[model samples]
Target chain A: MDNQYIEEAYKEGFTVRFAVKKRLFSEQSEFQKVEIVESTHHGKMLFNDGAAMVSERDEAIYHEMIAHVPLLVHPNPQKVLVIGGGDGGTAREVLRHDSVKECVMVEIDSSVVEGSREFIPKTSCVFTNPRLRLTIGDGVAFMAETKEKFDVILVDSTDPVGPAQPLFGPEFYGNVFRCLNDNGIVVAQGETPFYEPEAQRSLVGIMGKFFAVVRPYNFTNMTYPGGLWSFIFASKGLDPIRDVRVGAEQKLGDFFYYNPDIHRASFSLPTFMRKNLSGLLRDK
Target chain B: MDNQYIEEAYKEGFTVRFAVKKRLFSEQSEFQKVEIVESTHHGKMLFNDGAAMVSERDEAIYHEMIAHVPLLVHPNPQKVLVIGGGDGGTAREVLRHDSVKECVMVEIDSSVVEGSREFIPKTSCVFTNPRLRLTIGDGVAFMAETKEKFDVILVDSTDPVGPAQPLFGPEFYGNVFRCLNDNGIVVAQGETPFYEPEAQRSLVGIMGKFFAVVRPYNFTNMTYPGGLWSFIFASKGLDPIRDVRVGAEQKLGDFFYYNPDIHRASFSLPTFMRKNLSGLLRDK
Candidate 1:
């Protein structure tokens, strides 16, 4: 086939390219202007009115793994708080659990939610759920004002930048600690184990300060640049993995995503990761 | 950006589009052509040139999990046969064990071996080792011709289609059972647990008919369409996970992939998978 024909195939977006480039989504309505002009080791940043909706390539694995792990860990988890899942994939999975009562999604960008609802329908199903309470504002600010503690809190924000940078800081984690019930657990996409070891180290370090128990886990996803990503689980007064109790006896549905076996397997670290996390342990 | 501008981003030659109208490569080359046109529910395939390196996406996890589980199970493993690993990543990991003396790799595509050596350099390093012997031909035919038995035989094929379809069938598995020395083991990549349950069930069913022990395992990789994937390990004599041992006494190296702790963890099934795999197992 000629280059022109190949070019046509590429333009159709039938085959999603795992490449790095600047992405720009112009604002059509009364929202922020979306322009993504930064390059990372992973795929291109996807900006909606100046905030990341999801990275073009690495979004699914991060969104799926982060949402599924905590939901599987907690038995009969009802009330949930999604701090910054503007894309709504996490919220979609959270509502899949029959036991979930209400999911309060605090997205900083109203434009991201709106754009994603139109562009990415697979993720946007969360908004259609009657149980979801969508609030368009600062996630950190919303958490501070709301005393309604949740059984599970998911911090599904982008990398600590612009509005999200505060979400990774010590104060945000402390507030997340305050916003969770006694049996509550929190899982967040930490960073790439290869590219951003320092970011993972710092986030886990701060999480250790606020939560009595913190655990780091790894999952392999190819769309991501380095092929491996990590997530950190922080709980106020419970050991995240220890608290999990799914067995052969438990009745579970057909899940394409998460389970108890994977719950334990996710915590198994490679030697390179073990070396990086040598002295850090959150066993307070 | 104009349509012409957006078209420029698409790269030809390596891209695989799903729609029938958008296939780039149609003519069969000297290498094989494996087309996943219509599975029960997985993605509809355009044609794939067999000349292209066909690798199980999670090469590290699949290679390490298959080799280590059986080798660790046996008291001493001195011989191994790796079927259909042209890239040599599997052989590289098998060489890590000090107990093994001879390892044979049978791959049909010599170009894939040469191309992977030139392109994917890290995996290609295994080809240079003196302990490893490379055979270029059909693995099933080679296995039937040999009177030589192996301590462990690893069937590392691409997805079950084209040249590899027969590898998952009962006839080839019966040969694999005979090729193994008494108390020897075999492991192969089972299809995705989420997307292709029939493929998983069929392969597991075939292995169960031929071997005394058959078990399915899973690992999550993000780069693939769905997050989780499954692999099955079948042994003629011993339980691979039960007999394996790794502890503080063992000296480990810089492995970015598998470890002993993960060996046991990998065997643990999630509730959803457990439900799907129910009543599939037969008495030994």
Candidate 2:
């Protein structure tokens, strides 16, 4: 196998390389440098500033967990908001629900969506769906100004080290809290506890202040940094484990990961993570 | 960074590379190639047959989860048997319990143990523990021929791809059933479910025949192929989740990953995994 393009992903003191068969597209987006590369093994992959975002092969794991988990918890989510999921995989998953009438995705950069359509055409088709409202602006500003409330808010941002750092902050969460309905649920793709311990601990702590019930869920994402990725869900009325609607899996279409059993199981954090987040949760 | 050794581990479809600072020891054991190399970030690392066995940095996560989960489930495990944990980490964790009087370790390769003592001294200190009786012999033969019955039987072998394949077979499971007491529990280091789905499903199916309770638990191991790894517990009298001893975490020393909450949570398989395993469990 003669591979030309190679992206070296450095995380948690190790280097993992994904061999790209061909570079499909590259652009200096306003938010970051967005690149889409075709790979032999992982299929078409989208990278933001040299970091992996979504791949055609395993993006379903990330997308399904982020979208369906919070969706299933809320009884009837009519309106939903997605922050920073430019590749449209998050929006695709959100629209799968029969009750969700409107899904507004606020992506900072338009080039990522453009690249996704041009290179990774399969998952990107949802961007053109009439039910999806694609907004090209700052998610923070959109959440603050828009009076339209959502039943669920999904943050599909990148890692917190760079431009997506603000998305994980309390202010952003506060804005999300305001934009959501009174009994709404919000979930973000939290970084892995194994790789980013402090970040994961702090994120749960920040969300606990604004919401009555804040819980973090985990899933196995092979393309991600440590393969153990998490999504932090904070709800006003619904408990993620208790409020999950029975027979929700029946309404959902061909999913690679998310199910009712997985929804309940995701909240069972390891001892180290429970120790890291419990004190933070109890501080309030 | 000037490095002497670099190992590229290929698993599933991804490649992870670890940089080694120095080679501490090397020997061709009768069973496999035993090599201990000092890594810059991971501390001392052990490799068997060009595959990672354990690393000093995160060996606690693997060792603790493997040994303590089954140990805590059983009320009072007096006699324990370890099959193929040559690194001595399993022996160290089993001896932590005050109730366990003896832990017998049977490793086929003496050179693996010899290399561990010479290189990874911290985790390998249990080789000298008085309660542990080390036996260097074929584990399969020992289980078949020996009349000794153990309260807890732990299989801590390598990947099921090569020499370790036989250890996961139905015949070996039969030997384990014969060597265990009437109310005994057997736990094996099952392969990563995320990487090897068929193998994991088959192992569960095979174990279902011999044991009334066969459940798989998961943990995150950074150095492993997939960060998520599994340990399958097969028992005759005790249910891993229902019979887990309370205050088990307090009884043990400071642990990096395993705990009572995690012990219960680990059995909560992912949706795809539950779908894979439930079918196998339902077969019997």
Candidate 3:
């Protein structure tokens, strides 16, 4: 009688909601929650360990856009680092590049990594790859001490809250710059352009001061709170947009997230976003 | 602590969820319900009358993208018909065109119109304009009997559900084709490409059969379930993409939503979307 109550079980607890209109998936161990009345495309997921709101059903968009942007720009990226992406989605994408010999994922929350491995099998595939090294530590602190420099560093932190807030600050960015090679590139998940214009602008402004080429790219993810989200790539040298190259022979079959065409399309910004960037740059 | 329970209010013994996220309104009325969350951006609102979720701040993006696309494409859009948009946001945009001499809106529910006018004042401004005419009737039925042709027809209906299901059917599109003059364009709120790829394909396929030119456009509305939502535009004669023209002199001051640059940019679909469109068209 009560449509609101869901008997679904998640990693944290029983997935109980007053109402769940659209259930994309409901199995014994996993479920996806799409709010009947309002939702972004990818429904919120209830896994055995934790819950994550799917910003997009096709994770290729976010994973490819985030990882490839910086990876392509930094030529000869042998050593790469991913921060806060315990789900291993970013690391999975990072491993796609044959040029990369080593990848280290530093996620603060071990539970998220464990949960992702158990529930989100698509993302968990990254861990099974021999090239990836998983580290349970604060990314900010990890970057501070690591003398071993990476050619590319990806801060795939959650929304600017909890452990992710410091990642947005200038100090963390400076550390990221220090921990990277001279030609290294760093990319972070910037918030939605529609909702957090100020935050986006500020982050861009801060990164511009620290990096030579600070470019922001737009991607659409439905599962996130807002329909449109952005990611900012700050590099010491090359332009991500200009230097991007996808090999014809490279394994495109394994990729559900990134491709050559999307590589170009993701960089296109709407008028408001372009205006915000111009205004933010002008203020600098 | 319990964020799950949605309080229902009985209005004349009619049970309704107290949805209240309207920014134009200062006071919390009985007809509105508001949801508060740990959102980095503007708070979300769901208007009860139209069963529409309107973010307190970002309704402009949805309204502007929907209204301006078709309006700008038709060179001399004088008579406009908006179906199922009780919120009056699309009408507000339709009235913005100086070339539009008359704008008629047919809404199925009079309560939605009244509630929007009371709570969403900015959107309701269109109704007060001298060129606007409001009609409460079944839009499909009205289209059938009326010989009056429109330069632009904006199908601003809810998701294909409840009363709006008829709007997505073949008969309704046939009526739309008849109601439009030569060179007339129609814009409908298609669902998200990620979540509702089939819905978009269906609409595009149906509209493509009736119209010479059919294209799908996207906008980022954070309040919507998916971060990115798609809208399909079908023109009887003109190409929605190539036909767009906004004269420099006609350009108004500071539009937060739609502009000439964005007009071109919105059509630039990602690889996934492009593939979807191509596949759909090839199948046809």
Which candidate has the highest lDDT of all?
A: 2
Stretches of model 3 off by over 4 angstroms after superposition? A1-58, A72-76, A246-251, A254-262, A270-278, A281-284, B1-50, B246-250, B270-278, B281-284
Model 1 vs. true fold: TM: 0.74
lDDT of 3 by residue, A240-283 (tens): 65776557315435444355655565666776788888844321
Q: What is residue B240's positional error in candidate 3, in angstroms?
A: 3.4
Q: Per-candidate interface C-alpha RMSD? A: 11.6, 1.9, 9.4
Ranking by TM-score: 2, 3, 1
Candidate 1 chain A: worst 10 consecutive residues by lDDT?
A3-12
Each candidate's B-chain TM-score, in sequence, is 0.80, 0.95, 0.82
Off by over 4 Å in 1: A1-15, A18-79, A86-102, A112-132, A144-151, A181-184, A191-198, A218-229, A245-254, B1-29, B32-62, B115-121, B191-198, B220-229, B269-278, B281-284
RMSD of 2: 2.4
lDDT of 2 by residue, B1-284 (tens): 23554454565356666777788888886667888888878889888877778988789888888889888988889999999998899989999998999999999889888888888887789988999999999888888898998999999989886667788898999999998887799989988777788888889889889998888888877787767789888898688877888887696878877777677777777767777776565211
DockQ scores of the candidates: 0.19, 0.59, 0.25
Top model by TM-score, which number? Answer: 2
Please give the C-alpha DockQ score of model 3: 0.25
For model 2, name the residue pairs that clash.
none
- Per-residue lDDT tens digits for candidate 3, residues B46-152, read 44423335544677888888888888888989999999887788898888888899999998876667656765676777788989999988888998888999999
Candidates' chain A TM-scores: 0.79, 0.95, 0.80
Candidate 1 root-mean-square deviation in Å:
8.4
